[model samples]
Target: MTETTHNTVTDERADLLETLAKHRQFLRFTTQDLTDEQAGQRTTASELCLGGLIKHVTSTERNWANFIEKGTSVMPDFASMTEEDFARRADDFRMLPGDTLEAVLAEYAEVARRTDELVAALPDFNASHPLPKAPWFEPGARWSARRVLLHIIAETAQHAGHADIIRESLDGQKSMG
Candidate 1:
């Protein structure tokens, strides 16, 4: 490849990483100055809470990044799940007992670090991966690595907005001006 083309791609990757980082900063800002109880409180009618949003996004990004790294998936054993297991899965969007904002934030940082490292080390952004056999996805759809990164950015941006609203309801605070 030409030097100019290489530079352009590097610039684009940096821009994408910067955009994701900015959204993540907003999400973190929303949780600032909040206690564990406050972070877990359902300030609005929606089931979403600050702590839960952080956990959800962290897990979602990490899982997708892992899929990109590994071409195939080992689907979860839903059939063998007990009633309690199902209940816990249902509550994955919630901050149950023992959940803390500090822990969630720390885990999220680790996820971000791992994802950034993976992205930097990737040779081709156009590499393709087969769609996992999940009921929620179409049968034969495939996604390129670039698409996965874009999806992660979109998910983070969307959840950042959600976190802003939740934070506003908490104490009339806004994540941004």
Candidate 2:
């Protein structure tokens, strides 16, 4: 069993995972009681929707987890990406046809499960990997496993806030409340 000291790597990992779990629940709470059609509705002027945000976070976290396990992340080829490809990619955050709330949530749950297992099995939190080449990322930047986990927690919290707003706008329900 892992030790549970406040500043230990095990403690930090446990805290991050707990925060991720809470925020993930907040995200799911936002979609609670909403029909699939309502979930896809754009309550705000922004393109983001509750279901889509959930889907996006799930995809983003899975990619980051994979990056941590391996040395690099698998990304789509933007150079070869046609306009059609880009448009289709946009569907990640938009509840398109055939995208149901249950299906998306199930997929997100599976991703989270895999991520948790990977984090638990990590040999060292300080282990580092060079980030993949991407214009959005700083050049030659690398992140330790601990940092990557923190990044995932941050991403989840930020998206949870976005989801809270969208959820509040819909039927005047707040996730926090």
Candidate 3:
């Protein structure tokens, strides 16, 4: 039996949200006490930075949440992206000029709040839509809102691990022991 709260989420939804929150906290903890420069600095061979990870996760969550409501129209046709499009996407992995840690974190918080509200208010987890046409996605494949939430959780957890590594490299800090 699933319990509902004032926000009206089922027990399953609450579990999903709790897991997502834990990962988000781990990711955000990696950037604590860091300056913008430090946040943006790439600490490893890969082009990932703490601030960029936060930005990328925020964008990803926003897009997926939009997909839950609007379907494939919310996603870009990755198969047809041009050089400029690719370049712009690459920017999601870097801290561009004038990008502030504070602003990035603020945006992520807003996106997260929206996603949490969306999850709470969702009428059904089984509602699904065909995936946008992309090379990586199988043809005719569809994903339910529940699946999308799981994907988001996986993405956040994966990147949080990456952020932990980057943060450890940047400084002596660890998100966990």
Model 2: lDDT of residue 93: 93
State residue 97's C-alpha deviation in candidate 2, in Å: 0.9
Which residue pairs in candidate 2 collide? none
**Alpha-carbon deviation at 39 in model 2, angstroms:** 0.8
Q: Which lDDT value does model 2 have at 43?
A: 90
> What are the per-residue Cα lDDT tens digits for candidate 2 across 1-177?
543333344766778788889988988899999899999999999999999999999988988888888777464544567889988878889998999999999999999999987787777777898877666778889999889988989999899999999988888898865
2 or 3, greater by TM-score: 3
Question: Candidate 3: RMSD over Cα atoms?
Answer: 1.5
If scored against the real structure, what TM-score would every candidate get? Answer: 0.87, 0.89, 0.96
Per-residue C-alpha lDDT of model 1 across residues 1-177, encoded as one tens digit per residue: 421243344776788889989989998889999999998999899999999999989988888898788865632444466788777765657888999999999999999999987877677777878777656667778887778899999999999999999999999999889
Off by over 4 Å in 3: 1-6
lDDT scores for all predictions? Answer: 0.84, 0.85, 0.94
lDDT, residue 146, model 1: 77
